[model samples]
Target: MNRKQIAVVTGAHSGLGKEFVKLLTEDGTISEIWAIARNKEKLDQLISEFGNRVRVFSLDLSDRTSFSVIEKLFLEERIHITYLINNAGFAKFCSYDDITVDESLNMIDLNVSAVVALGLICIPYMKKGSHIINIASQASFFPLPYQNIYSSTKAFVSNYTRALNVELKNKGITAIAVCPGWMKTGLFDRGTIGADRATNNFSGMVTPDVVAAKALSDAKKGKDISIYGLPVKLTWLFSKVTPPKLMMRIWLMQQGIKP
Candidate 1:
């Protein structure tokens, strides 16, 4: 059987991941999408909406073994991968001392390790015009006090993405790191735990659809960074020019974290 071209998307159940699924489905070059996430029920719902073009995998990306499944699929099917969207990541907002060691490590495992592993695994299958979009955060632009571990993982993502872009340029594969600000997703509540949700509520939320739309367009153009919103663009600029200490101070003040 001649298998169809594939697009692999992680975190495919909701928010940006869901939007990415929709965008990829519209691309006629890719006929099958392998959607990976831990939420089987949500995956089923997404599959219901998109039909057989969506193949759901209920696996946790945080586990090192999970990535092996992807390699196995590629080797067995011998299909070309046109897009690899590494969108599965999470952030726990709170002070360092307050967060447990296990919690911090899990963030690193999901937000950093899994992303790196998948990038290494997928690049061999992807060729010119193929795109890999890694979901980073604007929080990565500076050292965030309350969101320390999460933001640090994102910084690694941003730096690694740029390096990967340059390396892949010769091969015609484009790798982009998308650093978006707060969005209207369920994760917003997770981030505000033990902190005042109202503190950062002033910035406003960007719809995941907008972020997904802009990212897909930017990825096709071979852009290194894809960011949404004027506020987030300005924040990225501020983080670059301002000193680390000043950026931390500003973040703390904005998040209602005391000195």
Candidate 2:
């Protein structure tokens, strides 16, 4: 019997990551999945639930050393990684004056650097038809007030994915950026920015399952950029027409923050 196709999903412990795992596993096309995350207990529980089809990897994406383990697994198993989903990210809300340099840098590390590094690292293991999905955000469409670092990181992902998609097209490898708005995940509840009174109003957003479904569907279709939901799409359109400074001022005012 032919071996089933393999997929790797980062941030698989919760939110859209967990939903992606469930959706892909039930699709009947994928036979094996590597659910990567830092939480071992949650990973183990998912493994138990999904049985032999799902393998849990205790991975900290910020740790560069973990790439070697992924490389080794790919080679030894002779697994063709048909899909790679970069879904791990964090957010924080702080005024430009209140946010420290270190905090901003860390967000860059996880949100942009890690995503780029993983895509590069996994390239060798990915076959011609493989797909790489980078999770960006609607914030990429415009500058987000008080959540500057997080918004910038997602914007980087959006632009990077699109550029790489064009470059890799010749090689038959597809890259897509999945941009979703206000996902109703613990990401906000557990986020530094989401806890703030200024940002908490944006809570109770769209569900993870909906985002995952739309993203996966778009990935399969080889879309260069998938912006989910009507509100997010409109936001993207608005960004194109609105001047940056004016938009920034408006957004800041909406958040009850002075620019």
TM-score of each: 0.95, 0.92
Q: Write the per-residue lDDT of candidate 1 for residues 1-259, one digit (tens) a residue.
A: 7656899999999999999999888888898999999999999998899888999999998888998887888788877788889899988776677767987898899999999999999888887888989999887898877777888999999999989999999999999999999887877666666744223544767889999999999998889999998999999888779999998887778867678
Q: Write the per-residue lDDT of candidate 2 for residues 1-259, one digit (tens) a residue.
A: 4544889999998889999898888867777889999999999988777777999999887777888788777777766678899998888766665667876777788898889988987887776889999999988987877777888999999999999999998888999999898887877665654334345447336888998888888877889988777878888898999998888887776667654
Clash list (residue pairs), candidate 1: none
Q: Which whole-number lDDT from 0 to 100 does residue 59 have in model 2? A: 84
TM-score of 2: 0.92
- Which residue pairs in model 2 clash with each other? 93-193
Each model's C-alpha lDDT? 0.87, 0.83
For residue 242, give model 1's deviation from the true position in Å: 0.8
Model 2 Cα displacement at 253 (Å)?
2.4
Best by lDDT: 1
